[model samples]
Structure formats: structure tokens, C-alpha cells
Target: MPMSFYAQSTVQGTVTDAGTGQPIPGVNIIVQGTSNGSTTDFDGNYSITNVNNGDTLVFSYVGFVPQEIPFTGQGRINIVLQEDAAELEQVVVIGYGTTRKKDLTGSVALITAEDFNTGNNVTPENLVNGRVAGVTINTQGGPAGNSEIRIRGGASLNASNDPLIVVDGLPLNDPRDLSNGSRSILSTINPNDIESFSVLKDASAAAIYGNRGANGVIIITTKRGKKKLQVSLDSNTTVETLTDKVDVFSANEFRSFVQANFPDRVDLLGNANTDWQDEIYQDAFSANHNLSVSGSLLGDILPARVSIGRSDLEGLRKTSKFERTTSSVSLNPRLFNNHLKIDVNANLNFEKNRFAPGVEGAAIVFDPTQPVLDPASPYEGYFEYLNGSGFALNNVPRNPVAQLLQTRQIANVRRYFGNVKFDYQLHFFPDLRAVLNLGVDNSTTKRFEERSTQSATGFNASQGDF
Candidate 1:
């Protein structure tokens, strides 16, 4: 029998502080040159399986020096990590420049990638939740939810209150641009591609941007390729059940109660109690898929990344559905031996929205005074078009099912939009960098609608584009 691979490896270790000989908690112990790793417990004991005799074990702590010790078939290895003071002096990137944690005069907070990555439906401010002070994040109801952000007590009385969003160096078109009382741009951005986000609140930090800086700025940095060959994949699928259903009365229940009250004129009340709204609504499901790839270009001349994503969404009502597809590609290439750098980025989006028709204004003619679907009369419906040269029944209307079936209405909209931008970076002087940028945006919207002829109620078909 062949020997199992798992039978040949075992690594165990204890982690303690070098300064005081006290047990260190949450020290990450990993086998060198491998993804296999484990953390120390509260008592500082850790065991990593599947490590061979020749493999090296590395001990790492956030504020301590990382130690690598060669393993020599030992059952137990003890390690102590010395605290690193320089790590505390490290500068963090703020709005304009880097600042040490203790030296910062203004308030600035940092949020790690691990904390914000948990939410699948993360909003712009969701990334900063609980990590910052004096910032409020508001999320409205529904799948196409709206998120409102306010920093340091909102400004402007009768004007817009939404925070400004800047991606890379470009100020994004108004967040309200896509908010036609429904959708917005924040929901469209794929969170997986985001590398980091910084919120600029105070004037000292935002004044450099000018004008729109009154509302503050949210700087978004997208992922870029590294020098080494690297490939990564992230996939998220969300299953959300229907929160509530449309209110409707059953077909039989609608008819029975009407007759029970007015037995003598039961037929007349039947048309008034018809369940039209119930017929047009149903439960729906939604889903989203995203794929992204990044890598170096030609081993150092350039680095690029491409990402594609799609969202298949449906409303609780059967008649409504929305689909959006987006693709983006970015390239940062060096010229003249890294002295000059150029960045080119482009994005394309395609969207489709559709909805079904419902009852029209003329359907109100359904009267309780007269019975619909008259049995004695040759014409089943109470109302009819061109009944003997402009003559017809007076009060009641036709069967709603037939009226709805004969009259079909569809609303369909499709849009295509994209942008291409180029930025040139010059590094000619020390402590100073300059940029020249030019970009063009192009977009087109098209709409098509169809309405079937309603011969019974004297409604006609119409079609047009907008």
C-alpha cells in the first residue's frame, strides 16, 4: 500500500513575548513558503499539521518582529518575538500626505480590508461603519436600496446632501445622476475590485479639491497589478427570500362575498369586486455575478486589470425585472524608464428594464348598478364598441380578463454608456508631482413601448421611441 501524504508531517509551537516571558495571544504561526497557517490561542499554544521535517515555521505578530526557524523533525518548538517600535512610527496615508498615528492633528480613522470585506451588499459608507467618528450611514429599504452619507453635520439647507465620490483622480458624475427616483451609481460599482477608500471630511483636508468639496470626498482606489505573476478569484451569491407579497383577494372569495350581501343583484356586484390586481402580481428572485483578473504586463513595462460583472434582479411584483451588465479595464504603463507614467482606463455598461401593463382608466366603468357578462343578452359583456352604430350598454363594463388579454402593454428600456480617460504623470522634481488629464464620455438612451388595440373599450395601440 502507498503511504498517505498526511502521515509524514506535523508542526507544533508555543509563542511568548521576548521582553517579559508572558504568553502572547493571537500570534499567527505559519509554515514558511506556504498558505497553511494557524493562530495561537489565549494561552499561546498553536499546532500546525502537515509540516515535514525540513519545512520552516514562521512566527509573526503585528507589533513584533517575524521570526523564521528551520524545523528539524522536532515535536515541539518554542519562539519569542521582540516588539518592534518602528512599526508604531509607520505613516498612514491621509488626504494630502502620510502622517504618523500620534502626530495627526486632525481626526482620521483607518479601516482594514478584512473588516469591510464581510458584507456582500456593502454601500459606500458601510466600509467606514464603526471605524470612524461623526459619520452617519443610512440605507433605505429594498434591493435597489439608497444609501445616504453625512459627514461632520451636513451643510447646505435646500441643496443636495449626498457626499461626493471620487474614483482614482476623477470626480464621479453626480451620485444623483442615476437616481431617477429609483437607481444610483453606488449600487453598480463592484466592491470586490475596490482596494481602499478614504473619506475627506474637514476643510483642511478637502479644500485642495475645491467647490464640490463642501460635501466632502470619498476617494476610491481600484485594484492594480503587481510586479509578480498573480491571479485571484472572488465569487459571491446571495439568496434573498421575498419579504412580502402583494395584497390580493382570491377569485372565488371576491365573488362569493359580493353575492352574499346583495343576493338579488349578485351579478351586478360581481364586476365591481373583480380581482385584477391579484392577477398581475407574483413573488420574484434576484442574483449577482462578478469576475475579475489582474496581472503584470510584459514583466514590468505595464500592469493591467480587467473586470466584468452582471446583476439579475427582479421585483416582488411579477411585472418588473432589471438587468445590468458592466465591464471595465485599466492599464498603467511606464515610459522613459519609469520617469513618466501614463494611465488609461475605460468602462462600459449595458442595462435593460422591463415591466408589464395593468388596468387602465376606462376600466372604472365597471358599475355595480348593472351586471357584467349578461346571460340573457346575446352580448356577454355589458359594454361593447360600435354596438349598432354608436349604441352600447350604459353602466357596466366587460370581463376584466378578456379586456386585459386583448389589451397588452409592454415598457422596455435599454441604455449604453461608457468613458475613456488618459492621465500623464510627471516626476521631474522632488516632493512634487504633476498630472495632465483628458477624458471623453459618451452615452445613449433608447426606449420602446407597445400597446395592443383594445377593440372592446375603444382603446387603440401606440408605439414610439424616446
Candidate 2:
């Protein structure tokens, strides 16, 4: 055996983002086989003393890939780290505890932030749309509208197909009905705030959640503060248009066919022309913005993160829209020689929505020759076929656009979800650990729906606030 002695020297370096080239503060740098270590500051600079040429330097950060570089008498070494997709997905968060995927068995699926769908994924369910193998995301209408998420399909017809949603150890309700304009309970959560998703598909994998896991279990872990202080902004705008307009006759096309086929019946048609499908649909725009700040608090003793996000989603239907504001805070701290870990996370969400019921089917069958509006006609200036008793005719269809606009359903919802967990490893047995978790989920829903007296669906008017 040959033994060699290497002189110890101080090493200094900067850590930067691989893609953005931005300075990354709070990265941990440690020399292998030694306690000698240091953390980068706000400028992404770190100086570690007593590093030998034979020693290996390890650089690690949350979200970014870890790196190990062997010291070869270099005084300074700058490093760039790419975002690590496996940082969140490779480690599993479940009822028992965090376990690596390679060590876990049963029908389990993982999806990290990197695996999320691109474009305007405003809702939580939309993030996993086509990514998971057995999970099916069924969206109704358009963005911000109701959605159905089924894990390996439904187990029973009587119960809901929604999987049990556990966010940071807090269980929450999912979309169930049309009461809320945006029926989804998870609508308040910002998709950008999500770190990863673990789906327990099989009975054995979901057994930890008990009966609630019968449908399946979806574990959602939100992002926590990184080792370094970091600021990030995510903004995106999406435009949606009717790709192929029903493939039906337009106002002009219907008029020509009506005249060529039945000249005598043309007398019953009105002079004004309208395309029902075109009138009901519109070029929609959706916008999402998220800003987050994360770093160490109290001299690195506590890692804290704060995030704010807003989403404005416009449905293809002219009358439907959803707006939401979301804010969250997370703190994780280690104590007692890294044996005790405490985690606290909280989220607040507010939403305002105008739900659009299914009226697209009616748009196709409605007459294209009729006008959308008439001054003399009732129903809020929308043309309505009335019977002798001054009621909207049962046989004749109402304007699809009017059906959406005249009957208004507005919902304002607010939700707060929070959780705190404490885990302590036994000093006697390093592998043994004791854990305690507490969580709360609270929500308030307010709705106002009205059908004007003159509208086709309205024989009486109904309204409320608060």
C-alpha cells in the first residue's frame, strides 16, 4: 500500500444556474470524509478551508442536481447545476414516510414538476393530465371549469371516482358537483407550487390511507425552501380558439340551403341571420403568474419559503370565467444534531368563478337563420320564441348564447389548508424514528344564481350575496 500526504488549502467558488446563469445562494459545500464545509451566500460564493488535493468536494442544493468534484490543487472552482427532475420524483412521500422509489414496491407512480404538462395547466388535475399511466384526467368545458380525475377508473358507481388528495399530509376534497363555478376543490392550489405527485394505485400500495384509499391515493408534496435563497417568477398566457366551428352550416350557408330546398317554408324564417355556434364561442385568453422567494431563516436554522400566485382562466364559452389567488408558506427546520425534523406548511386560496353549463350541444341543433338579439323581444334583448301565454315555447330551443348569459351562476370560494409534522430519530437506534402529524382543512363557499324574468329559463328571479 502507498500512502500519500496532500497539503491542505482553502477552496472558494461560485454556484450558478445552468440554464439562467443566475447566482444560486445557499448551496451546501462539504469536503468528503471530513466535517469541513460551508454554504454559498447571496452572491453564490463559498469558501471552505482545509481542503486537501486528495479530498473530494461535494456540492448539493435543493431542486438542482448534486455534484462531486475531486480537488486537484485548484484554488477556485466554479460550478453550474441543472435542475434535477429526480430530486422530487425519485423520493416518495407517503403515509409511512419518505422512501426512495427503488426501495418501494406495489403499483406506485411518480410525477415530478419536470414531468408536468406544458402550456396553461391552471388546475392541479390538469398537471397530471396525460402523464400518469393509470390515472385519467377528464376535463369538462374548458380551463377553470369542472374536471373528473379517476385513478384506474371508479370502484363503485355510487361513490365518487375522485382519488383522495393529500397535500403536504393534509387531506382535501376534490371536484364533486356544479355548485361551485369551478367545482374543483383543488382549484385554489397553484400548479407551480407543486413539487411532485405520488400515485398509489394498488390496494397494497394504498393500504396506508385505510378506507379512503379504496378509490386510490394521490400524495402531493409542495416545494419547500431551498438551501440557498432564491427568487423565481413564472408567467404564461394562453390563447384558445374554436379550431373547427361545429362543421355545421353558417348563417349564410343555412339561408342558401333553406331557400333552395323549401322556398315556401322560407316565409317562416326571420330576415336576420346568426350562427349559433359562433355566437356561443369566442377567442379565449388565460393567464397565470407565480412569484416565489425561498431561503434560510434565522441563520440557516430554519428554512422558510413564501409564494404568491394568480390565475385568470377564460372559457371558450363567452359567459364563463375563473379567477383565483393563491398564497402559501412553508418552514422546515432540523434540530438536536439532525435527529429531530419539524415541518410546517400552510396555504390560502380565494376564487371567483362564473360556471358555464353544457350548452354547446344546443348550439349545433339551434336554427342558424334566427337572430341572436331583437329589441322588441324579451329575455334581456336575446330573441326567444314565446308561446301565446308569453312564455318561452317548450318545443322551440332558446338561444344558446342567451342560455349561457341570461342564467348567471357565480361562486366565490375561499380555502385554507395547513399541516405540521414532527419527526425525531431515536438516538439509541439511528434507523428507528417517531413521528407526529397534525393537519386542518377549512373552506367557505358562497354562490349566487339568478335567471331573469324575461330569460327563457326564468319564470321567477332568484339572487343572493354572501
Candidate 3:
């Protein structure tokens, strides 16, 4: 029994994309000229046990160039794969179908994930900023505000100029806010899950959409699984501050101007000088997180993505704050030898906003020489004007600071968007296919406002829901 002994070892390794440094899953790994084979997991990790030291392993994946390595008694071996340029040709998604880049006859622009804008972009429109020609993106309002995208300028004088948005084969209605026009629907979408964007600018390119395409058309396609399995996570945080402010007369400058211009009314100057603008402005913050997983099983591909985001913004004016929470999920599955495909996308968004009182407007017109608070007046401890007799002054807008602190307006909005699509190609004829799609968009909003009873406008409270 003093005989010979054979030693066995275990081999483990990871596969990654050389270009993007991302993991590649579902890759096939086999021992050369042997039946021993294994597949990588979602994390791009694979292991083979009971292997000899001199065994040669082969790594192969679709759309990528394969590589071979010898297991020189090492426990771990990592490999990088290069993409096959020939297999990476451009693919365009049109109104009702898809076409290769060389087959397109109309003027169209394609934007892939690699071309998206970097940073904390809350809306999909922001992702395309300064990336496309003849297209403009304008952000309205403050930090958590929505963006307005214009393609080739205005298309109509009396009608809406917004382009039609189509997501994963389903057309979305205009995301306009009829009441007060303060909100936009595109703000609910998660930009991290977008795979590509197709813009139809010319009349010939948008003719397929008919009347809705007059303004333009944008088709959004989300990510899906390939021949490999992959898992990825992304997160970031941001801090925001006022970039520039309007130049206003300082306390001493205003006093000097008033004394020189209105010598007779010099007594109108208050004892204290305050900068109303500085009293209201504050800082804001935001954070975002995203996770995605995709792989293949039993000759079928499954891809899923989820994202969670939150933003808290403080406006330059006091009591002006906006908070929003967004979440979304996308799932895609392929079955029946690639003949059956199903895609489901769902999103949920919630927003809360507290608008400043007349303070923001009054800060510009209110007397800068006036004191922020009065001690002996009837409205003690509150910013106000009073006469020598200890009575409240009249015929003037309420103190900007008092208006900001005493009045309250709160708005809450909840929105949900979901869609499901199915496609089946006939086994007899691969060219012919049948499709079914269903979708829904729903939103609810509630607003509450209240004014103090001691204010000049008296007590007032109102609530609305839609």
C-alpha cells in the first residue's frame, strides 16, 4: 500500500468585461477535451472541484471572444473578456418595430447608457441634457423641480409642444399637471434602468405615430438579460447650495440712500437693519441607490432591476422645502426557445412640498432698514411694524419673516405607473409574431393650507384632493 497517490485540487475564478470592468455572468467554462463543465453565477463567479493541476480550462460566452487558461495549481484565476466588435453593431427601435442602423432611412438619433449625463439626475429628461443636437432641456423651479424638453423648438402655437413618450412599446399620455401646472410625470421614471433612447425628429421618422408625433417622438428601451448573468450596484449622494444671488442694497447702503433721497421721511428708518435674503436661504441634499441582476436559466434569460431614491431640498426662501421618494422595478423574461417574451415595468413615486408664504416675493419689496422683530409692539416677538403708541402699523404687507413662519401650505402627491407586454412568435414561421400589451397610469394628490388667525388676512384653512 506504499503505492502511488493522485492529488486533486479545486479551481475558482471570475469573469469580467474588459471594456466596462463589469462582471459577466452565465459564461460557460469547460475543461479542454472533457465533459466537465460549469456556468458562472450572477456574480460572475465559477468553481470547479476535483481538477488536476495541469488541466486546461476554456471560457466561452456569446458576443464575446473566448479565452483559455491552464490551472497551474492556483486556487483562484480571474479572466477579462473583450467584446466582439462585429457583434456589437447598433440596433434601433422604431415606432412599431426594430431596424438595424444600416437599414434606417429617416433621420434618427440614438443615445445609449454610456452617453448619459452623470450626477444626480432626478428625471429622464435630465439624462439627455446637452447630448443631442437641436434638442434643449430646461429645468423649471428649484432643486427637486421638473425639466422641460424641447425637440426642434415649438411645433404648435396654441397646442402642447411636448414630444410623445413611448416606454418599452407602450405609449404614455402627456404628463402635464392641469392644476397650477406645477408637476410633471416624467419625474417618476428611474434613469438608471434605461438601456437606450431613440429620438425621431424629422416628419418622416415620426410619421408612424400620426397626430401625437407632430411635436416629436422619444422611445425609451430598458435593460434586459443577455447570454450571461450579472449583478451591479450603484449609489451616490449630493449637496446643493445657491450658486448666485441678485445684488440688493445692503442695510447701510439702503439707509444712506433713504436719508439722501427722502430727507423729510428720514425718521421712517428703523433702529435695526436686516438682510431679508440671508434670513431665508438654506442648503439642500439628495441621495440615490440602484441594483440590478440578470442571468440565464434553462435556456431562458431573466433580467430584473430596482432603484430607490430620495431628495430633500430647501429653497432660498424660508418654509420652502421639497421632499420626494421614488422607487421602481423592471422585469424581463424570455422562454420557449426565445419565441416567447414578457416584460413588466412598474414605478411608484411620492412627493411632499411646503411652499413659502409671500415672504419670497415680499423680500424684494419689503423695507430692508426695518427690524426683523419688535419687542414692545402689540405683535411682540414677531417681525412687524408698530406706531409710537404701541399699536400695529397699517397699510403695509405683513412682515416677510412673520409670513414665512406663520403660514403653512403642504402638498402630497402619490403616483403609480405600470405596464405588461407579451410577445409570441409562431414556431411554423419565425417571421410572424403576435403581441399583447396592457398598461395603467394613476396618481393622487392632496394639498392643505392654513393661515394664522392673528394675521392681517385673518384665519384661513383649505384642503384639496385629486
Q: Using TM-score, give the best candidate's number.
A: 2
For candidate 2, list the clashing residue pairs, or say none.
25-228, 26-228
Q: Write the per-residue lDDT of candidate 3 for residues 189-247, one digit (tens) a residue.
A: 66776888999888888897998988889999877655576777887777777777667
Model 3 misplaced stretches (Cα beyond 4 Å): 1-88, 178-182, 225-231, 291-301, 357-360, 376-380, 386-395, 457-466
Residue-level lDDT tens digits of model 2 in 1-466:
3234337788998999998999999999999888889999999999998877779999999768899999998999999988886653477876688887656777788888888888777888788888988889877676665677788988897876678889988778654665644457677888889999989898888887888888889999999997799999999888999888768887678778889998888876777777787888888998899999999988778999999999888888887888999999999998988899999999989999887767878889777778888777756888877666555676566688888887788889888889999999999999999999999888788998887666766642123111
Residue 317 deviation, candidate 3, in Å?
3.5
lDDT value, residue 343 of candidate 2? 95
Q: Root-mean-square deviation of each candidate, in angstroms?
A: 11.6, 14.6, 15.2
TM-scores for all candidates: the values are: 0.57, 0.76, 0.72
* Candidate models: Cα lDDT each: 0.60, 0.83, 0.75
Ten residues in sequence with the least summed lDDT for candidate 2: 457-466
Q: Candidates ranked by lDDT, best first?
A: 2, 3, 1
Q: Candidate 3: give the clashing pairs.
A: 25-229, 26-229
For candidate 1, the lDDT comes to 0.60
